[model samples]
Target: MANVIRRAEERDAASLQHLQAATPGMPEWTQVHWLGLLSGDAIVVIAETDGEVAGYAVASLLRIPGEVVAELEAIVVTPSHRRNGLGNGLLRYLLAEAQAAGAIRLMLEVRTGNGAARALYQGLGFQEEGLRRRYYRDPVEDAVLMSLQFPQEAVAVEKGQE
Candidate 1:
């Protein structure tokens, strides 16, 4: 499969939106919200495999006061695309893209039971920092907050001294 990861274009909204809805363990975001993000500063990325959309992820550069952070809003891979390093590629792309945009950190919240996602994030240097009570509905899943420091090059430098 020639899986290509690229920014989600407006032309992909309908297909991407359907994929988002079909994705298990993903939040239901309105079509309007998805379209707004595509039209705004948010980063909506899609992965195409064999000429078909395989997965998508959404991220945002958040600014507050003097602080800047990159928030990975959603990362969803069609079950068919799982276990193929597609998730890893999308995350690495987001991390590098966000860092280039001046993000000092990357943050996200995943369900406590999502070991796959947790492990993936941890492998990329993200750490568990906190939790949100009942952040997900339709079963009331708690959110486990995770974050990774930006500029991964700095992490390598610091590790080299250890």
Candidate 2:
């Protein structure tokens, strides 16, 4: 069956936690965190395949003076769903929403050892911006900060031609 990406709802809290657990490098967030994302400047979306939650992504929208920026908080795909484009679908949905919300940039940090995730992000036009020392626990590792900047839409009217 094809994967369907949709907005996350309150009912998805438990399933989101389950996905997090099934993902090895995912951050451990509590129910409170999931609840907080449901109704704020945050954007959350989940991918479902065969009536099961396959992956999810969370991001926050920040209006910075003249531009809006999005910070990706978490994105995890179930073990069985990895490498099947579920993560890519979830991120594409989130990026479209962010762009509609006026966000011109997206930022995220991934564990340095997570080659799969890093490759996915890189393939999607995200560039490595920086590195954080010893960012992960359990298995200590550094984090590679990545960001993608969207080009501002050009105005319909030309400067001199108008």
The sequence of per-residue lDDT tens digits that candidate 1 reaches over residues 1-162 is: 799998888888888889988876666777787788889978888889998999888899898785568899989888888989889989988887776666779899999988999989999899999999999987899999999987656534434623
TM-score of model 1 relative to the true fold? 0.87
Judge candidate 2 at residue 117 and give its lDDT: 88
Q: How many clashing residue pairs appear in each of the predictions shown?
A: 0, 0
Looking at model 2, report the run of 10 residues with the lowest lDDT sum: 153-162
Query: What overall lDDT goes with each candidate model?
Result: 0.84, 0.86
Number of clashing residue pairs, candidate 1? 0
Best by lDDT: 2
Q: Candidate 2's error at 9, in angstroms?
A: 1.7
